[model samples]
Target: MTTARTLAVPAPAPDAAVKYFGAELGFEVDPDDLVRDLEAGRTDGYAVVETRAPEAFARARIPGAINLPYRDLTPESTAHLDKTLVYVCYCESTQCNAATKGALKLAELGFQVKRLSGGITAWIAAGYPTEGDKAPGIRCAC
Candidate 1:
């Protein structure tokens, strides 16, 4: 006689296009790799764009990121030069889609784009300081 047993296993999810740019306009980056690249300062081929507004941005942002605010990338604003610039967009929290939307908008305007893996929240979480807000805030990790 013989005994039979079954084992349970989990499968990895399929790639569902986490980071995307406009129709064939930019290169995309996964969260892990993007963090590595940014930390190494190998971002010469990339530019970080903040999708937040001017008022909100002044309170602090991703240090050197540019202010294009997703809504501003219209036909009028897309006239800027530097088509060869790679872009990464970010917003408030990692859960927010503003960064992704901003990246897509830039791509639609013929600019290369990528979305920040977790937005500004991730940056600050990583201990990278943001330049804004004069008040001192505490970081609490759950």
Candidate 2:
């Protein structure tokens, strides 16, 4: 019996985060590639920011992820932050606008941030981790 849950085409050299620099005040990241690296513990100097609320972070999250809800971002947020060049912002899903909003806000603050192309939903759909899916989203009371 043939299983329909396999990639028809074998991926070569693993997926790489595709940088879309020409976008309006932002860029997109290939979540598939990001998840691969994270799972393999091959992630480099990039910073993965979960735009989830603190309560959500307390519940669960991707290991090594920094919790910074979209509402907390400001010109001062990047201060004393790591020297990481790439900042990936992700929320609940592609249907959620928090990541994009946060990414744009970070860009305005002069941070090189990118939205996790399609967000965590895409990552989970790609068979990635859902360690934090149990944590519901926070819509920023601010």
Each model's C-alpha lDDT?
A: 0.66, 0.68
Distance from true location, Cα of 2 in model 1, Å: 21
Clashing pairs in 2: none
Instruction: Give candidate 2 misplaced runs (Cα > 4 Å).
Output: 1-26, 132-142
Residue 116 in candidate 2, Cα distance off native in Å: 0.7
| Per-residue lDDT of candidate 2, residues 16-59 (tens digit) | 32332345334676876677788788877678888867776655
The lDDT, on a scale of 0 to 1, for candidate 1 is 0.66
Listed per model in order, the count of residue pairs whose N, CA or C atoms clash below 3 Å is 1, 0
In angstroms, give how far residue 29 of model 2 lies from its true place: 1.8
